[model samples]
Target: MATAGNISFIPLTFILSGIPELGNNQNWFAFPLGALYVIALVGNVTILFLINREDSLHQPMYFLLSMLAFTDIGVSLTTLPTMLSIFWFNYTQIYLQSCLTQMYFLHTFAAMESGVLVAMAVDRLIAICDPLRYAAILTNSVIAKMGLLILLRGLCVVFPVPFLTRRFPFCKTHMLVHSYCLHQDVIRLACADTTVNSIYGLVAVLLTKGIDSLFIIISYGMIFRAVLRIKANEARLKAFSTCISHICAVLVFYVPLIGLSVVHRFGKHASALLPVFMADIYLLVPPVINPVIYSIKTKQIRAKVIKLFRRREIGARDNVIATI
Candidate 1:
């Protein structure tokens, strides 16, 4: 704790404000939030299982997708404990060290997700623009290296945040805006100068998400140019169709992300619930939606999922007959 003109501040624990509008009725949100968590967990796990079980999916594209599934799971798991505690149990107090740990994983997973998306964009660019070299360029070894680089980049970039956040003395008002700890939200509670933390946070976001988005856009531009060059309309349409799932994934991840950032940075006068809602959407929607989009848009995944269920049905019927 620290002193500011006879006032004691900087409590060891922070209180989470879970949907201030709901107040005592916050428990009502537990059902929907729990449902979303279940969907995200089941969906991403199913994608990973399908990708792993199918030998035909042992390709660079599917490999990147598996990485995305892992990242989504990380995102979902990072916030689940705190969100559940706040909504279900009304347990909102979080220790300083614990908050920092949550902030680290949350930001790290987010950065890693952005990195995976950029890698996916590059994968698509090579596949569409230079089909002959796609196999040569994105070998298993190369993909493995890319995955390592993404992990390392996330680790290095987010490693400083906890330390930076720990240096500040927080104000007496220990209430946080959301159920889970966030760098931006935590920094705002500091009574001391937070310029360094703020600038570093912005830099981290720019270096990761901003650069990743730019690269994705450029890759898509190249893909479009290559697709347009195909003389046959059918071939052009086929090439374009392959990107639909990825496009949807990108939009799902980035749109809510951008909205949340905008609300945090510029929407000072906006409803308190708006930022909270945006944050929830940003974190929850992608995990629940990405696997669904891929399953629906990618024929191979859809077919495999259908085949898996059919086999399960057959096995159940066989067991029933044997028992009878």
Candidate 2:
């Protein structure tokens, strides 16, 4: 597809795919996929609303949780539209520019989530390890700065991905394995020498997810050490309880991601459905699960959600009585 001097069309579209094994049954898959999307949307939105309405929750921990909720919404939006299109309508065509745009968003939000998780871990460390200094260290201005730094880091590093792809020639097959456009998934299809793209992709992963994960591990290590030093077992348990939700969030995000990476690099001979499921879990599972974990584990969120539903039920009953 290269012309003189290796120049080509400005925007070359490609066909996105779902599980080929399902064949005509792909439409049936839309129900569960749609349900996941709805759950993720409702859950994250509820988290955001709870954080916004509750003055008591206006702290560094909740601030970082709100940021995490925002990133979860972004992660869901980046992939859900195209995935629904493919599963429900069989609309598989995505323009080159559009694909790159999707990749940018999906990866950016993924990186941001990692950063937010690390921030939450640090918050927990301070709250547990040095409770007195927590307020002084994580002031409102400092939290604001952390949020901005996360955003800028996510956007700036992944900004060049699409531009780099533009320079390469996609002379090979244009078919992509997943419903969503991932940088690693798309870059392997290029015809030109992809050494630079591959190197950059590795570096990006290491810088964002890799380093963030390392920091999270270290923070938790410190937190557990601090908790162990407490004189009373009850006090230790209470302190450790605070980190359960965040620990769950970290697992949900990273486990599927690591599985997907392994499947991509080593499981070429594995079932086609394996990779698809891994990708789906990586993208969809965390957003849906994180909110539920928090709601169940954190008393504040649980109480608010219960009150929210009870209010709705009461309003409905009053409306019925008025009509009668």
Candidate 3:
């Protein structure tokens, strides 16, 4: 413990309790969790690669999707090392600085993900409500600026979290609830008054995810009204169909997020496993599922993915024939 003052000691490291109830059985989770991480990385990378390789996918929507994939990859990579270390090797101890850094990146990526979703919603709104001006409205330069703004927003919003967490003297037991460091989880261990931390955390959430969700809802509502005005049922259905994948992405991301927040705030007496499970779902599900939803629901993405696989299969067969 490092002495912060004459009377207080700040521990140099924090211990991560990876599902305390599981105990020795925590190792059993290693394989499944590792597999999910691997899938997330591969899926998101594939989405990005397809978007880059396919010229038809160079539109505003796919550009925002590539951003989303990049964010997902960041989220997975940020949590993978520490999480696997805890579950696979029982190396639950994380240095104070390391914990704070992880917390920063995790929250930053989360905020970026939210911003990308908002951009996607706006893309859909324009496409549905004003198809003629869609290309003019969301040009490549404009998309680039949006991406830059989202990155800056996330970076600026989360920049203070680690510093805030660092200023506290954590005299409470340094055992964190999850395998990875979270802002809320870390602040809870601080010995000092955390009213500021709590308020700031709430404010940060409201500023990023809250505002993003509101915009998305409003965008979709407008989209719905626009779609309804179309005289043909076929045209209305087609407009709605474009949103299926994004809607799924939003649900997957926000549903778990809401559940986790609810569990954190209101489920104190609830099963200890509840928060752990909710957090896992909140963090892990989006990255793994988003690509699949997009690939399945978005025709262009699905066709491109199938075409890529078919080309690989054909190349493999040609190589075998040459060997024979």
Candidate 4:
């Protein structure tokens, strides 16, 4: 059986300085990574709150957007500090329990993100293809039910990662290739036997995340087909513009995602750097761009954003005058 070897790396200074005593013994990536992840958490939490409170965002699409934001927050929480810990302190010795816990949350959040995207695709299909029933069919209660289904489905799909990974024996080479304890990579460290875990991992991925992406592709394909049938260029243009932001979001999420799992399964250090950069881009780009994307693409949302900003500016001016 193979488990990760204890690897060492360049420790981050700020993290080392934070807890001076453990700086020598413990991994020193806590401070900067903690800052970055906290920022990400705050931004995503803001988006979730805005999407929840704004009346304009009452639609099914925005509901799913909030869910996506929640998933991103979970993902960043699960991966960021661990990754920085691995990179800054080269501490790859995850205990049996901690490794499995990371695998579970990592997979759970991954599934949740995919599940929300699939729901968004389905919502788009209804809105575009059949507008009349959109409101009645996607009512608040119905949306809640869909959310429940998404969570249930994600839970069912990812339940195996931890169980399967835990059963394996680790003789040597437990050093995870990627920064975090990805499902496949953690399983690879099992020493005793892992053929079953490998098979199940593939199944879980295919059934959940892969299937969701496949259906999203199908949804877009149908949208493109419908676009072709529309005789009015202006109508087609509006429909195309609406979907563009979602397409861009999906691309940013899915492209480099498979790399982490793929590289860790068969080899080591093969795509470590690629996955590291991609991991940062995957989590960072979406939250950074989501607000801007909606503000630019949707007229009503843009108005709300502008109104909020104008209110803030007026308040600031009033405060300055009051002080004078």
lDDT against the true structure, each candidate:
0.93, 0.90, 0.92, 0.69
Ranking by lDDT: 1, 3, 2, 4
In order of appearance, the predictions have TM-scores of 0.96, 0.96, 0.97, 0.81
**lDDT (tens digit, per residue) of candidate 4 on 1-324:** 222454212111111111222334435445555666666676567667667678877788888878888888888877765666654665545555666677688778878888887888888878877779999889989889989998998888888667766555554344554556666555555555677877887888889878989999999888888877889999988877778768776776787576545545454545345554555555556555655565677676677667767988999999999999
- The runs of at least 3 residues in candidate 4 whose Cα sits more than 4 Å from the true structure, single-residue gaps closed, are 1-39, 84-93, 265-272, 278-288
Candidate 2 lDDT, tens digit per residue, 180-201? 8998788778766888888898
Write one digit per residue (lDDT tens) for candidate 3, span 106-187.
9999999999999999999999999999999999999999999999999999898898888888774788888899998888
- lDDT for model 4, please: 0.69
Worst 10 residues of 3 by lDDT: 1-10
Query: Which regions of candidate 1 are displaced past 4 Å?
Result: 1-10
lDDT of 4 at 23: 32
Error in Å for residue 285 of model 3: 0.3
Better of 1 and 4 by TM-score: 1
Cα TM-score of candidate 1: 0.96
Give lDDT for model 3: 0.92
